[model samples]
Target: SKLWGACRNPWDTDRTPGGSSGGSGAAVAAGIVPMAGANDGGGSIRIPAAYNGLFGLKPSRGRISSGPSVGEAWTGASIDHVVTRTVRDSAAMLDVLAGPAVGDPFTIAPPAAPYAKLMQRAPRSLKIGVFTSSPYETEVARECVDAVEETARTLENLGHRVEYARPEFDGMALARCYLGLYFGEVSTLMDRAKTEFGARDDDFELDTRLIGMLGRTMPLPDYVRRRQQWNDFARALGAFFEGYDMYLCPTAGQLPAKIGELDTPSHLQMAARLMLLLKAGKLVHRSGQVDQMAMESLARTPFTQLANLTGTPAMSVPLAWTAAGLPVGVQFGAPHGDEGTLLQLAAQLEEANPWFGRYELLEAMI
Candidate 1:
C-alpha cells in the first residue's frame, strides 16, 4: 500500500494514475516531462493513457526487441515503449528505438519510413468495427460508451467507414488462460526473491503474496495448456479482422477510480488469510475464489488483452472527457505489423479534435 504513496491523477487529484506504468502516466500528464517510458504485459500502457489522457501504444510483439538483457517478459505479452502527449513524439521515438537488438529471439522489419513522417500522411479510407460494450461480461460506464461513439462519429466525418460490430470470442476463458501465465510469473518472482534475500511472506505485498501462492498451486501443465490456448484466440480474432482495417472500443470499462478507492490492503489481508486455508489442504473450496477475484478485476479492463493475445498493435487515443472533467480514451487495434495504421489514425484524431490543452490545464493546476 505504501509503494509510491498512490500515484494520483493530475486531472482529478483524487483518482488513480493507473499502473504499473502509472509513474509514467502521472509524470507525462502533470507536464513534468514531454513523454516517459512504459511497458505493457497486459493493459499497463493503455490503462494509464485512459486514466491520464495520453497516447499509449502497445506495439506488436516482435516489433521491438528485448534482448541482451532479457530475451522476453511474460512470454512476449509485454513490450516496451513510451507514453506521450502527442502522436508525433511516440512516432519519433518508435523510429529511434524499434528494431532487433543482438541475440533477440524475434525481429519485425522496420517501417518503410520513419514513423514521424508516416504520421504526416493521411491514412487511406478505412473500415472500422466499433463496440461500446466490453466483450467480457462486465459493465461499461455510460461516459466510456459515449466517448467511443463520439470517436466513431469523428472517424466517419474523416471519411473512414465506422460500423457497430465486435468479434466473437469467449472473454472469460481467455481471461482465465491469461491468469494462469500471469500467476505463474508472480510465483516465479517470489522464487527469485527467496534466492536474492531469503525473502519471507511479509517481504511481498499481501495481495502479491496471495497471487504467488495461487501461482504455485497451478501445475506446470495447466500453464502450458493456457499458453497453447493463445493460438486458438489468435485464429479467431484474425478471422474477425479480415473484414475491417481496425477495431475500436473503450480503453477501459470505467472512468478512473478515486485514490484509495482501489486500495487493496484489506483485500490483501483476506488473501493472506486465504493462503492459510489452502495450506490446510482446503484446495477444492478456495481455488475458485482467487480465479473469481481475478475475473472481477479483469472485467473492468477487458478490451486490451485481446491484442496482447494476438500480438497485434493497439493504441489508446485520448478522445473525450467525462462530465466530471476526467479523461476517457477510445482504443483502436490494427493487424500485426500495421502500427502505421494506428499512428495515422491518431494523427487524424489529433488534428480533428486536439487534446493539447489538457496538459496545459493540468499545468495550471499544478
Candidate 2:
C-alpha cells in the first residue's frame, strides 16, 4: 500500500480526496492542472470536479472513445471526459476526446463544427428547466439549491428563459433499476478478472469485492428486467427533454465530504455505506445520511449518476462558493448528441460570468 504513499487529500492531509478519481480532483483543485482526465461509471468525473471546483462533463455514452483498451466501460455506461475550471475548457476537451476508436461498439456522431470553435459563437435564447431535488426524491443541500438558483439567474440574465419544473418520472424506481444494471456490470467484470488472473475477493478493495459478491447473486433474468427498467427510464427522460432544451440541477445532493470518511478495510462495509448514503439522500432529500465521522472519508456523487444512466450530456460548472469557501457547481444536461446547445450556452455563461481559471488558482497556490 505504501508503494504509492498515502493518497493524501490535498485539501487536508488528514483525509482522502475520494476515489477512484480522487487524485485527479485533488490535483486539479490544488492547481496542479487546469483540467484533468476523469471517467464516470457512477459519478467519478462530476464528483471529483465538484469537489475540486472544476468543470466536469460526462458526454453522451458514445461521445468519447473508450478504445485502445476496451469497447465499453461498465457495460457501455461509463465514458471518458475531462474536468476543468472553465466551461469552455471542458468543451474544448470534448472536441479532442469525442469520437469512437477502432473496434468501438457504437459511435456518437461528431458535431457540425469543432466544439472549441463553437464556444466562440453565440447561443440562441433557449428554454431551461430547473429542479433542485433529485429525481429519486433526494433532498438537495441548501448550498446546492442556492447554486442552482444562482445559475438560473445567470441563465436568465444571459437571455435564456428559465422555469421551475420536475420531470414526471419516479426517481427511486429509476435508481433501483440503474443499480441493477450497474451491479450486473460489476459482476461481469469480476468474472473476467477471476478468469484472467485467478483473482478472488482479496484482490480488490472492499467496495469492489462487495460488487463481485453481489454480481454472483444476480440472475440472468434479473439483468434482463433491469435492462428493461433502464429503457423505461431513458424513454421518460427523452420525453421530458422534448419539452426543454436543457435541465439544470445540483451536481451532487451536497458538497464534497471531507477526505478519509469512507475508507474501510472491508469491501462490504464500504458498499453498504455507499448504498445507505444514496437511499438516505433519496429519503431525506439531503446528503447528511453518512456519519459525520465518515462523511469526509466517503465521496457523495448521486446527482451526476443520472447522466451516466441515460447517456445524456451533462456538465458541472463551478459558479458559486459556500460560506466555508468551498466551490459549489451547478449541473446541466442536454439530450444525447446535443452537446452543441450545451456548449453554446456554456460559452455564453463563461463570457458573462468569466470564472477565474489557471491564473487565479496559480496565484492562490503561490
Q: 1-366 in candidate 2: lDDT tens per residue? A: 323755654544555555467788778777787788888877788776666667777788888878878887776678888777777778878887888788898887788899888878898888988988766554568999998999999889888999997556656555655566665777677788889989775676556554444555556685677666767767878888889888998887776664444445467476566754454323322343222312222224556667777788888777777786667778888899988888788778777777675337534754
Per-residue C-alpha lDDT of model 1 across residues 231-305, encoded as one tens digit per residue: 988888788789989999999998888887775667667756766565622372245765577567787788888
Task: Show model 2 residue runs off by greater than 4 Å.
Answer: 1-19, 198-200, 264-299, 357-366
Clash number for every model?
1, 16
Clashes, model 1? 1
Instruction: Name the candidate that leads on lDDT.
Output: 1
lDDT for residue 283 in candidate 2, whole number 0-100 = 33
